[model samples]
Target: MKPAGSLALLALLLAGCSAGSGLTTGALLGDDKPAAPVNDAPARAFQVGTASARAVKCGFNFDPAKLKTNYLAYEKQQPSGQDTAKIERIYDVSFNGVAKAVAGEGEYCSETKTKTIKADLGRHLAGDYTPRVVPKEQEEGLFSGMGSGGSAPEYKAKHPMDNSD
Candidate 1:
């Protein structure tokens, strides 16, 4: 092949390689938005837990295990020579709110409840909110066995008549 034809083929291959890597030529050229990380595990877990707690406070039965969380890195930047990444974790609470509505057993969460969930999530992500443990009385089955006293154990040596009986 001629030199021009060879150079064109090489360019095409490079373009194909870059595109396959999820970074388009436009992104590489600074014309398109860069891709962000999605559904980060830690962030999602925190969000779901926060939402469930807030829902419980609002008198709704929401299960954290049933909550669905989605995370998106709204902004990410690496300083010119720095090795660390500056990433902003953005939570999609709306989807989880909808999921709560579908999976929840009680009344639908009010708008204020959703806002409180989001606000609490923001505070949690910002390291400002500390989670409060539910009181033992509020937890399920805390008093189910209240009247059952401990039974005394019978020792075989002390009760020698067992075999004859």
Candidate 2:
């Protein structure tokens, strides 16, 4: 075989080996250094897991084995560079909420819940996180208007006492 063809065969062999034998082409060809970390929104780390977790949670609530163990547990074991622990509490609380909603019952597993689940799951997967704004304690009343143009029309109201003029 030609040299280039031989090299191509070798890479394919290494890729296949990596899948089952844990022998990767990068390690084999001296490119074994770890990849650089990707900095992203904290929510990005959960983008994939949380999507699946929603579906799995339903099955997990009624039958834990059906969805294959817990989301945080299984996902953490994977080689994701992002920290899954940071979002553990979110998954925990959400899962507990699911369980509590159908405690001692199978309503969560019913067809009736499918529409709600689909709508929520669709929104969950459609990725745009807007944090709620909470006013600080020190900040007094009369908040700034939302969006760019903060030009709220000013109006002068005449008080009864002011009409003494």
Predicted candidate 1 versus true structure: per-residue lDDT over 37-142, tens digit per residue: 2233323333444454555546554443333322222222212322112111112232233343335435445674466565555544453323323222322232
**By lDDT, who's the top model here?**
2
C-alpha positional error of residue 1 in candidate 1 after TM-score superposition, expressed in Å: 50
User: Candidates' lDDT values, in order?
Assistant: 0.36, 0.37
Clashing pairs in 1: none
Candidate 1: segments with Cα more than 4 A from true spot: 1-44, 47-126, 141-165
- Write candidate 2's Cα lDDT for 1-165 as tens digits: 454554454344323322244356874675635422222323332332333444554553333332223444444555655456544533343344333334555444455345434444554434322111111221222332223354543322221111011
Model 1, global lDDT: 0.36
The CA-based lDDT of model 2 is what? 0.37
Off by over 4 Å in 2: 1-54, 57-87, 100-103, 109-112, 128-165
Give the least accurate 10-residue stretch of model 2, judged by summed lDDT. 156-165
